[model samples]
Every structure is written in C-alpha cells, then in structure tokens.
Target: MEKNIQTKYWVVDGKEPDPGIIRQAGEIIRNGGLVAFPTETVYGLGASALDDNAVEGIFRAKGRPQDNPLIVHVADMDRVWELVSGVPARAAGLMEKFWPGPLTVILRDGGVAAKKVTAGLDTLALRMPDHPVALALIRAAGVPVAAPSANLSGRPSPTTAEHVRNDLSGRLDAILDGGPAGLGVESTVVDLSGETPVLLRPGGITPGQIESVTGRILLDPSLEPGAVIPGKPRSPGMKYRHYAPAAPLVLVEGTPSRVTGIVRQMLEENLLRGKRVGVLCREENAGLYPGAAVVGAGAGGEPGETASKLYAALRRLDQLGVDLILAEGVEPRGVGLAVANRLRRAAGKIINTGQLHE
Candidate 1:
C-alpha cells in the first residue's frame, strides 16, 4: 500500500452520478491514479486497463496477488471489442443478455490491456457494470478500467462506499460514493476463452441463469469447497482466501435444523471459554442464539437477500469485536451458491453435520 497518500472522497447519486464529479474521478484514472467506485455488485478499485503501472497499483493497494487476474470494466460494446481478440457466438449472446449486469465474460485478450491486468494470461475478463455511476465513470474516463473488489485483499468485499473507505482510505486516490451496491457480492465470472464455457466464480448470476443463456456450462473444479487450484487463477477470488473478516470464522453446513443445533452448541462452548462469539444466520433464527452477538443475514433464508446482506453482516460482526464468528451455511443453489462459496473461503474451519455421526 502507498504510504501517507491522501484519498479524495465524494458522495454522488447512484442513479445519476454528477458529471462533474465523475469527470474529476475519470481524470484521476486517466492519469494512472487509483479510484474506488461503486458497481451494482460491489465497489471496485479501478485504474486504466491499458496502463501497467496503474494496474499494478491496484495489486499494491489491495495487497492482491498479481497472479490473480483483474476484471476490465467497459461502458459499451465498442470498448469491449477493442480489448478482446474475438467474441464467440455464445459470448456475444451472453453479452447481449447479461451485459450491464453482474456477469463477467472472459475472452481471448486482444493485447490491448496492460499485461498486469491479465496477469500474463492470454485471456482477459470483461464486464459492463449495471450501475449508472460505474457506466458514467467509465465513459468519462474514455478507457477500459481494470478493477477488483475495493476492500483489502481477503476481506469481505465492500458493498457500500463506507466499506471501501474503511479498507482503502489512504491507499487510493479517490472514491466515488454512489451509495450501497445493489448486490453484496462480486460479479459472476464465466471463462469463454476455453473450449467449454466454465463458471470461474459464481456471484449474483446463478448457474441456472447462465445455463439458460449458454446451455449447460461447466463449474470450475476450484469452486469445490477445500479444492486446490493449480497454476494461476483465471479470475479473481479463485486462488485466494477472500471475504474473510478480522475475526476467525467457522462455517457450519447441513440441514437447517442440524446446522442450528451445531452452531448453538459451538456458541455456548465459546462463551463458556470466555470468548466473544458472533453468529451469522438467517433472519428467522435470529432469536435462537442467546448471549452470542447474533446477526441476521437475510429473511426466510432467501438466496438473494442473503447475498445482498452477507458482507455487511460479516463487517458488522467484526465491528462488534467478536473473537470468533460462526456463520450458518445456505443452500448452494441460485445466488446461494455464491454466498456459500464466499463463506467456505472466508471460514477458517467448516463443519458438515452430515459428515458427523452421533
């Protein structure tokens, strides 16, 4: 991280980012300075995709590994074409359907983006964010922006400008505060640079939703819980432990009743040990845990709701200064897959009640 650098902060309307403020932010990017801005999914630490030095700054600011690639954000199809070697028919179809949303399509690099952005890979990930502020800032910059989640590496991804400020206050050049991100997770990454379209990382866009567009896509093996990733990661969040909070987190998975039972037992054990315990659970079960610092992530265990509130809940628990956090796992379906993936990666340990015998 850069030392003692001052960060400029600005609050703007999410629906309509002030042109003047966006222009100023854009100028910072044009000059190879880092800027943290909001996307529909999460806030991104952005720099010019074409500038290697600027792209390197993103890695430096977040302490991110250079081997994990960054996503390039563009405002329009023209810019997308300028950066990718070719858009396959399936990719084109996906772009038509999911562009300007929480989907990232990886294609063969056209050799236009900075080498640092692709992390020396032959492919590049690109997406058009579905937020007015993101679009406006990219348009104002007049260059493709290479970005990764704005928070410090391995922390929960920022869902609001305040989260960005908390993690990256003095490390970056500017922050365009466009309110809270609509989705609490990062974009869904689809790798089309291969023979078969592969889901590199699940996010707000679900497997069912992507398969609806591109016939049955393959989930990357790395998506499996506790699986090891070989070589470099083709996309962000694939090779590293991400979305973790300062406190150690333990995730419990099984039938809701079983998980609830296990978490309650663990919570009691921790409290007895004189440790502060925090519980991340569904809204319906908020009252079940006593004495522990409990946070309800979503209502009725709804996938979308859980995802949109997951990071905030984690950050909140950390703020409450819990010594340990116990998160309840959601079903790995729809957006819940993304939520579960993040929790698995964030957790220091995972207990599957199904794997435990009475």
Candidate 2:
C-alpha cells in the first residue's frame, strides 16, 4: 500500500505467452496484489476471486464502488461450474455457444464463490475470457480472477497495456502487457438467472447473436439513477455513466447530414464562446467539421475497427486538453451497437441531430 511501491510489467504477444512473466503475474495475484492484464474485450484489472483481501485490493486500486460487482474471469469452460451455484438451463446453452469469447452470464450466487466476487449478492456475473495472455495468467495463478476494466472506474476502459500503464502505473502491483485488446469494448453481459435471458449490457457480442443461441429475446433493464437491482445486476453498464473522459462529451446521433450539421453548429457555438474543442469522427465524416482537430479511427465502413479504437481515441482527445468532445454516433447494429453505447456513455450528453439542417 506504499505510494512508492514498485510494480513490474511484462509485455507478452500472441497465443504463446512468456512463462516467466505469467509466473510473476500469478505471484502477485496469490499475494493479494493487483495485476492488470489484457482480455479479448478490454484489459482487466484482476485479483484472486476467492481471496477476500485480494478482492479488496482490486477495489482500492481502481477506486471502484463496492456496490458495483466485479465479473469473475476463468481460464476455460470446465471451471465454470466451480464459480456459480446452479448454471440454469439457458445459461448452459449460452455457455455452450459463447464460452471463451466476449460473453458474460449472470448466475445464482454459489454462496462462498459469489461472496468472494460479488460482495455476497445472490447472483454473480462470470465470463471465460478468450485472450491467451489472460488465460495464461488465470491458469498460472490456479484460481478464478475478479476483474473489471483496467482503468480508474467511470473512465474509459484500457484497451492496450500502455493505456493501463498510463492510467494505473503506480497504483497496481504489476501489469501483464499483452499488446492491445482486440474487441476494445467490455464483454456482452447477459443475465441467465431469469426464465428469459436478459441482455444486461451489449458489447463485442450482439443481441442477435445471443438470440440465435438462446432462442429468446434479450431484454434491457429499465435503469433508474442510483438504483441497484437486488439479486444480480441485469447488466454491467446499467445505472452508471461509464467510459467517460476528463472533459465534457457530447454525442451527435441521427442522419449523416443532420449529425454533421449539429457538430458544426456546436463547434461554432463553442468557438464563439472561446471554448477549446476536439472532434472524433471517421475520415469521410471529418469534412463535416472544419477547423476542429479531428481524430479518425477507422477506414471505409468497418464498425469493428471503430470499436477497437474508441477508448484510445477518447484518451488521446482527453490528453489534448479539450474543453469539449463531439463524437459521431455509429449505427446500432453488430459491433456498432457496442461502439455507440460506449460513445453515448463517454459523451455525457446525447444530441439527437437527425432533425438538423446542414
């Protein structure tokens, strides 16, 4: 807990992991210290799930709220039953379809295991992360890991290990530097605790994908301010303003022309008020806002590429010291839905610009 405590970070690449680095990361988890590592989704700040003291360290390191439960990450499907009490029939089916990918299922709290991870809730959110480095560390540590995004809570999730180092360098015991996260968004969290599977939070996996596997429509909970659902949280991103940057953010949604018009209008107004501004948009979309410093993330029309660059773009824009950020919203389909969801959260204000005249 010393302010000047030294932490080691090891950079690993691809499916093959460095055994020495994995061993060190495992040691840190075993000792109740925090270790940040990359998942296929976002990089996760991890600690031993069964160790109460280690779980506490994750909360302290991330400055996360205790009420907001952490997702338990396991190495593989075989270990799923060990963490949750009864894997409901629907949960079993979904796991069969989406295990080892960007899907998190909420299950009945398996008493002690649930207490260690969810702070004693009757439900627990669990996932088997598909990243090799993450799996390597979990396997090496020989325990389930309770992990959330590896950045200060409410800020953008760290996609790259460097992002982790930038936001949490001195705070964590060590970081497993496993390049950049592939999906670059949080996992799609689904609640299988109910009769009908509910889509708690959308991420790398789409709702259609979940429906195809479970044969049921995934429902989004009606979130009220400061309300925590009693059992398991329906979804991870519910009832919270997450993935936010330091500066104020405004989301521009609607038709292309209308969104562009609103951006131009907002930029002009901010400029008139002598406020510094930054814009995040696609290259084709950048021409809509002239004079504003634009950060482009994807080429052509690839939503996956856009999703991958989201948090990093926000971090860059935040570092630029802008007073306001104007983000263009993507179509809410496939990975684009996940991208837009994060952008909407990051953008504090959502502007429906579909009605605006260019």
Candidate 3:
C-alpha cells in the first residue's frame, strides 16, 4: 500500500544535518518512503532493504529495472553479516581495508534482504557507505538501506544534493542535502559469490588497487561496451546506456593534442550544421575550440581531479542547453580509468585516435 508522502525539501547547514531532521527522514524510510542521501561516492536513493514495498518505491521513483538489483548499505562492519550468509576471505580483507568507504561486494543473501531488493537473486550486493550523513541515517533508521545512484536511471549519477533535487524532486519523499559527494563516483562492485572474485563495475576504487590486496582479480566482461542488453545488467552501470546527459555527447579519445584536434573538427562540423556545441576537455585545451562552449575536465596537476569534476561538468553542459557535447577522454589509469569509463558511456559515439585499444 502506498502512503501519502508529502515531499519535503530541507537545506541543512554544515556536514552534519540536524538530529531531528535526520530522524524524520529515517522515520520516512521506516514507513516505506524514499529518501536520497549523500554517500562518499555519490548520493544514493535509499529505501529499507528489508521492506519489499519500501524497496519497490526506489525502482518506481528512479524508473530502474527490478532485475538490475540494488546495493544494500549498512552503517557498521558488524552489520554486514546480517545481510549476507558469509563474507569470503578476500572480500573480508577488502571490507576491512575499504569498508566505510566506496566498495560494494556481492555475497550470498542471508534471506533477510527483500526479494525486490535483490530482484529475487540468491546473491545480494552490499556496502557500508563512507559518508557521515549516510551513516547517521542508517543508524537512526536501524535498517539496512538498499540504494542506487540518486539520479534518473541511465542518466549521469547525482554528485550533489541539488543534483538529486533536479532529477528527482517531486518523485520522492525527501533528499538529505549534505553538500557534494567526495569521491564523486559510485562504489566499486565486486562479485565474491562466484568461485573467482570479479569486478562487476569500476568506480572510486580501481582494478589495480583491488588487485594489490587480493592478488589477480577478474574484470567482468559485462562492463565492456556493447556487452550487455539494457535492463539486464548484473550490476549498475554494466548496461550500455548510463551516466548520459540530455545533449548528444561524442567522446574523443587519443593524446591530448589528437583529442583536441578531433574535437575541433567535430565542433566545426556541428557548427556548419548550425548546431550549438559544447567542448568538455582539460583546462589546457579549452582554448582549442574558440566558438564552442569549453569546460575543463579538471585541473591538470591534481590527481583524481578529473574524476571529481566529470559529472559536474556534464551537468553544467545540460544547464547551458547545448545541442552537442564533445568530451575529451582522460588517461585510462587510477581514478582516471573510472572517469574515462563514464565518459565512454555518456558519449553516443567514440572516435578513438589512439594506436592502442582500451
């Protein structure tokens, strides 16, 4: 049964929200309502994982597929065992090192998580988010919250509370405005239920980082482009269309100069057709395309800066209402790998000028 949920929007001061308001949001979740809250990686649209109806609200609100499955989030490490039958040795190591951070692991469900939350799959994806606001809500609600990126399904993930309101204001119950997300990406999802540990999706954590601790880890082929059908994703972002924007985006891949040249060429071609173009590239290359609206991918010197600035840049382009978006690909290493992955998906066409294949 659906309850009459009055949409409430609150703008709280500082990193910590008011205890009274946080409790109010928690009660909403307890009563089978949706709430968007900030996590370290990104804001997640949350519902009680144990409540089938509450979990269903998330899918309806986001227009997400039921079979796509959801990530159950907990506040503490000890709370993990309640969701999953048992954690693998490698998964345990990862959780110990990365839990209370942006890592989600697939485990055999303990039968407590709602069928809707897992999409009736025996295994459930679980994580302990590394954000103060997220942790407080879970602790207050006293229930494991199953959540996905707090944006419309297949669109760019929301990095700030305002982004959540823009995409999902009237559709949900409330949004916890805890400022912008830190990592500005989703959690790294690893499937540990199978014999070999596999990375289902890449996000804030990189494959190299996970490999160091667990030895060799396998990358899920589903994460590759054109590998899986839409709505059948084993994990979030495995589907072909994800993290996209309203404007048609084309990704230019190669060295910075090569990418700049290709973007300039594409910008000119679009302009010849009288199309308004936007260029998303590094700060150094912004001047390459004079007529186009140029936005920096991130500051050149700062590490992980590109990943941090990616979604915000895309959102800005949408605000400008550009007809075409020409995004420059970043280096495919460290957090840059995650940034590049999102750009690849966001782009409708990818022109690879590089000699090496990804």
Please name the candidate that would achieve the greatest lDDT relative to the true structure. 1
Q: Which stretches of candidate 1 lie over 4 Å from their true place?
A: 355-358
Better of 2 and 3 by lDDT: 3
What lDDT tens digits, residue by residue, belong to model 2 across residues 60-120?
7777766778898988776777766788777888888888899999988766563647755
**Global CA lDDT of candidate 2, please?**
0.81
**Where does candidate 2 stray beyond 4 Å?**
114-116, 222-234, 355-358
Write the residue-wise lDDT of candidate 1 on 1-358 in tens digits. 5567899999999998789999999999999999999999999999999999999899999998879899999999999888989999999999899988999999999999999999989999999999999999998998999999999999999999999999999999999999988888899999999788999999988888888888989999999888889899899988889999999999998788899999999999999999999999989999999999999999755889899999999999999999999988888888888998999989899888773112
On lDDT, the stronger of 1 and 2 is 1
User: How many pairs of residues collide in model 3?
Assistant: 0
Ordering by lDDT: 1, 3, 2
Greater TM-score among 1 and 2 belongs to 1
Cα miss at 258, model 3 (Å)?
A: 1.4
TM-score of model 1 relative to the true fold? Answer: 0.98
The clash count of every prediction, one per candidate, is 0, 0, 0
**Best-fitting candidate, scored by TM-score:** 1
Location of the lowest summed lDDT over 10 successive residues in candidate 1: 349-358
TM-score of 3: 0.94
Root-mean-square deviation of every model: 1.8, 2.7, 2.3
